[model samples]
Target chain A: MSLAASQAAFQAWLQQADDAGIAPTLADPRGLSVYQNNYRVSLMACLSEAFPHTLAWLGAEAFEGAAARHVDAHPPRSFTLDAYPQGFVETLRAIW
Target chain B: MPSPHFGPHFGLGLRKPHYADFLGGDVAVDFVPVDFVPVDFVPVDFVEVISENFMVPGGRPRDILRRVRADYPVALHGVSLSVGSASGLDADYLRALRALVDDVEPAFVSDHLCWTRLGAFQSHDLLPLPYTAEALALVCAHVDAAQMALGRQMLIENPSSYVSFAEDEMTEWEFLGELVARTGCGLLLDVNNIHVSAHNHSFDPAAYLAAIPFDAVRQIHLAGHTARTIEGREMLIDTHDQPVPDPVWRLFAEAITRAPHAWTMIERDDNIPELAELLAELDIARDIAHQAAADHQVPA
Candidate 1:
């Protein structure tokens, strides 16, 4: 596959790891889980970092649930994690 | 390209918890411990802020940054340049960053060397790149284009990586050396990232530091990481949520011996302690850099 095609496939696998599965093109598929976990955890942590008060108020389990739903609904569009929390207040309000 | 100017100094990541301390306010924030004293003045040499946080059209972020900028030189550390993307640079993002640079006139602008965006989607993570000749060429081109767009030389940071590619032809340090040779961009050598990537990929951290072209490094970042056991193997994740670990501080001491003039900062993104705590860490960096300079016989 071409470089562009490889990147596209890898990204697809990253975004939808459970459904798409690791691309056969990668070196070792076992390590893919690390990247996948980091992807979700880091983004979720970004929201938690931005809305610490909300997280403290809602508690970990509830905040995690809200953040997971928010992540599912809104995959980050911008390159910075700061942009990931743009509509989080509304998302949390709706969920609550 | 004109070399980015960053005089030798130590600073802290200007986090929100310490905003009132830096920007001046009576707003009661709960994240900061009550026992912690919020001083009226922050005497750091510079304040590094996430460039994206201030990219908004107009808001309190900008106002706080403006007030803080007046007190100390602000360095714009971006996470979104995505210079290693195979697709291309984002035009709108570049435009917005350029406008911000114009407005803030930061001491320097820097971002990770890894790509965060692919096609229309942004992963919001510093994804690793294959260290091949083709990837090098593409990254150099993108870095050049980004510098052109911003009308200033940019610093590409070494990202903490979790995996290595089979198609790799060279080490990351070699890629960074070639990139600097090609694009004339500076390096934001994150000591913590070097330690993290080295441990994750099984490389010598000192070797990584020795391989770096010291002259090209304009700034250094020190941060904390989380150690996890994955598949019975120890993995150091660059969490940046706590104080700078001892091992990373040792690496920073070694790094500053080579790049003595680079400005250094402690980056604490999560579980941010009081401004005094970060400043104290910055003081440690100041002491280490001072001792390293003396050991290397470089006049401070």
Candidate 2:
């Protein structure tokens, strides 16, 4: 595939991975799995970084899972990973 | 102005895990460098530093930026500026950044040399850019524009990348050197990032530090990275989760030898420990930075 076409396909696969935009017709869905994992981990990483207290408050498994979900729902649109997540205390209360 | 250069001081990346610890006056961190919102907007500690995380306005985030700036030493770091892009500058982003900078009046400003926007679409991640001539011009122009907007010099940092571009024209060392020479901006040197990039791209860590114009370096960043050997090629992803590794410490020591008193910070975005633990690491950094300065200085 051309670079532009590949980029477009990749974008479609990425921005709407959850949606039914693209179907899985490759050798394996490992790349998509890795993408989702990285996305989840990155968001989780940012939340945990910004809110170490929350990690202590929620514990590792619960906090990581909760943060992973929260970030998936409300991912940062900006480019900088330094923009740590907020409103987690409330998010925790809302979910947990 | 601000300290004008980085110094051996202790600070904390304001985290929610220690919110009650801080609120109840249990943990005693000196400078609290806060995240985007939640931790920043509400009435938390007073001694806070604001990265570009708090740049975007409105909602709880912007409100927190104002609230935190009212009391603490707000330092702005822009991760989205994409300083190393060959495409062009994001004038709108710069204007928004200018507005935010004016509002916060931070202690210092900073951003990474990685690109986020390509052509028109901006990525949410700090995607790596080619270390080339086109990249250099785009970055210098963006930095110059950032300085113009904020009316003060900002700190540009090196990024850790998993991939390198094949169409590069110049080197990161030369690019950063020329950037400091042309822009008069400060360098937020991340020793861990240097280590990560060095391992990923087979370069002498000492040579990288020796290449930087130390005087232009204003702040330093130390963080933890996870190693992944991709396709038999070693790659260290700058995942700031755990403790600062040993080789990164070595690189940081070398970099500080060049710039003795740059504002030093440790970025831990995940699996954070208590304020006491983080502060302990910061204390260790201070000692090492001091030792580096003392050991490198010539008896004149």
Candidate 3:
């Protein structure tokens, strides 16, 4: 595959590892799970970082559930994780 | 007036919790409880702000940054440069970043060497790149484009990764060295990242440090990570949510020995402690750098 194609495949796999499955070209597909987990955990942590007060108020389990739903609905579009939770307060209110 | 070049300085990431302290305004000191008593102030040689946070047209963030810039030299650190993207550099992102640079007049600008964006989707993570001649050429071209657009040199940071590419023809250090040689970009060597990647990939952190061109290093980052046991193997994840660990501090001392003049900063994005606590950590960095300078016979 071309470089662009390879990068696209890699990103897709990271975003939806179980569904997309690992890249067919990868030598060790199991390692992709580590990257996939890191990707989700980091993004979730970014949301938690941005909405600390909300997390504290909602507690861990509820906050994690809300954050997961929010992330599923709105995967980050910007390069900065700081901006990932721009409308999260409203999202939390709507969901709650 | 142009900002004074404040030689090599120690700084901390100007986090929101400490915004009022630096910006000099009314903030609820009781808002967050801490072990250390809340103090009105602490002095830092410089401050590093996430470039994207202030890339807005006009708002409180810009206002606060302008006030802080008046007092402290700010360094613009970005996460979205995505220099390794195969689709090419984002023109619109470059334009906004350049405008912010002109507005802020930061002491320097830096971003990670890894790519974060792919086509219209941004992963928001510093994804690793394969070390190959083709990748090197592409990154150099993108760096040149970024520098030309911004009218200033940029610093590329090393990223922590969980996996290595089988197609890589060279080590990441070699890729960075070649990149600096080709594009005149500097390095923002993150000691914690070096330690994390070294552990995850089973490479010598010292060897990685030795391979880098010391003179090209313009800044250093120190941060903490989360450790986990995966498949009965210990993996260190660059979480940046806590204080710098002992091993990272050791690597940082070694890093200072090599690049004595590079500005160093502590980064904490989550689980942030009191500003005073971070300042204490920065003090450790200062002491270590001072000792390393003496040992290496480099004037501090």
Candidate 4:
């Protein structure tokens, strides 16, 4: 794959767990899990940090469910994590 | 553009947990603990702040950075430059960073060599790039554009990556050296990153260190990483959540010997401890630098 195609595939795999898309270009398929874990954990942490009060109100289990759903649906567009929290209000409303 | 060579300096990343300590003199903020008292100034040469955090128009983030700038020389480190992107540089991002650079008059401005944004999808994580000639040329062009926009030399840091592409035509060190040669940008050698990538990819850390262009190295980052097993194979993740391990410290000692005058700092983003605790870690860097200075002298 070209650099652009490989990068796009890697981004898709990271955001969507579409491992099949990136597995071909990967030097080691096992390391793909590490990147996936990093993407999910960092995004979850971003949401948890952004909505402390909402997390408190919704409780950990429910808040995590919502955050995970948001993460699955919304592939972050902003380069900064600070801008990621802006969409969580809609997620909270849609779920709760 | 001038060099980012700011004499032998040691510092720490200005994290949220220690905001009170950085903003000393009885300046009470809502986030600070009520029992927190004003302490003496932190004994360090400089402090680095994440550029994206303070890229806003007006807020407490900007206020905190402004106040911190008054106390110590600040280094504007960014994560969103995405220089390795094949598409091009982001004009808005560069403009905001240039504004921050103008306001801070930072000791050095730096970002990673990896791309974080691709097209409309921003990964927010440092994604690896295949070290091919095409990617190298693209990165060099972006670095040149960034330096031109900022009107100062910029430093590019090596990334700790988990994956390497099969099509890579060069090593990360060679790519970085060529980047410096082509664009005249300095380097921020994160010793921990070299250790992590070396361990993950089964490369000799010493070899990578030896291949580095030490004269272009203006700053160094020391961070802790976590070790984990993936598919029953041990891998090191650049988690930045623990104290500087022994091996990373050893590598740092070797790095300081080669690039003695580079600015050194420790990064702890998660599981952040007390200011004094990190201060102790910074002291470790000081000791290493002191010993390296005695052991090997870089001519002025």
Q: Which candidate is the best by DockQ?
A: 4
lDDT of 2 by residue, B124-155 (tens): 55655556566677678888987887788888
In model 3, which runs have C-alpha deviations exceeding 4 angstroms? Answer: A19-31, A42-70, A81-96, B1-6, B27-41
Chain A TM-score for candidate 4 is: 0.91
* lDDT per residue (tens digit) for residues B132-175 in model 1: 89889899999999999999889999999877777788999999
Flag the better candidate by TM-score, 2 or 3: 3
Give the chain A TM-score for each candidate. 0.84, 0.64, 0.82, 0.91
Clashing residue pairs in candidate 4 are none
**What's the TM-score of every candidate structure?**
0.89, 0.71, 0.88, 0.96
Q: Report, to 2 decimal places, the DockQ of model 3.
A: 0.50
Per-residue alpha-carbon lDDT of candidate 4 for residues B195-219, written as tens digits (9 for 90 to 100)? 9999999999999999999988889
lDDT, residue A14, candidate 3: 72
Q: Which ten residues in a row have the lowest lDDT in candidate 2 chain B?
A: B36-45
- Cα lDDT of model 3 by residue, B1-300, tens digit: 121353569999988878777855443455334533434456788999999888876987788888888888899999989999998899999999999999999888999988888887888778778788888999999999999999999999999987777778899999999999999998899999999999888899999998999888889999999988777778888889979999999999999898888899999988988787898999999999999988989867
DockQ-best of 3 and 4 = 4
- Kindly report the fnat of each predicted structure, to 2 decimals: 0.48, 0.12, 0.50, 0.77
Judged by DockQ cut-offs, is candidate 3 incorrect, acceptable, medium or high?
A: medium
Query: Alpha-carbon interface RMSD of model 1?
Result: 2.1
Give the worst 10-residue stretch by lDDT in candidate 2 chain A: A19-28
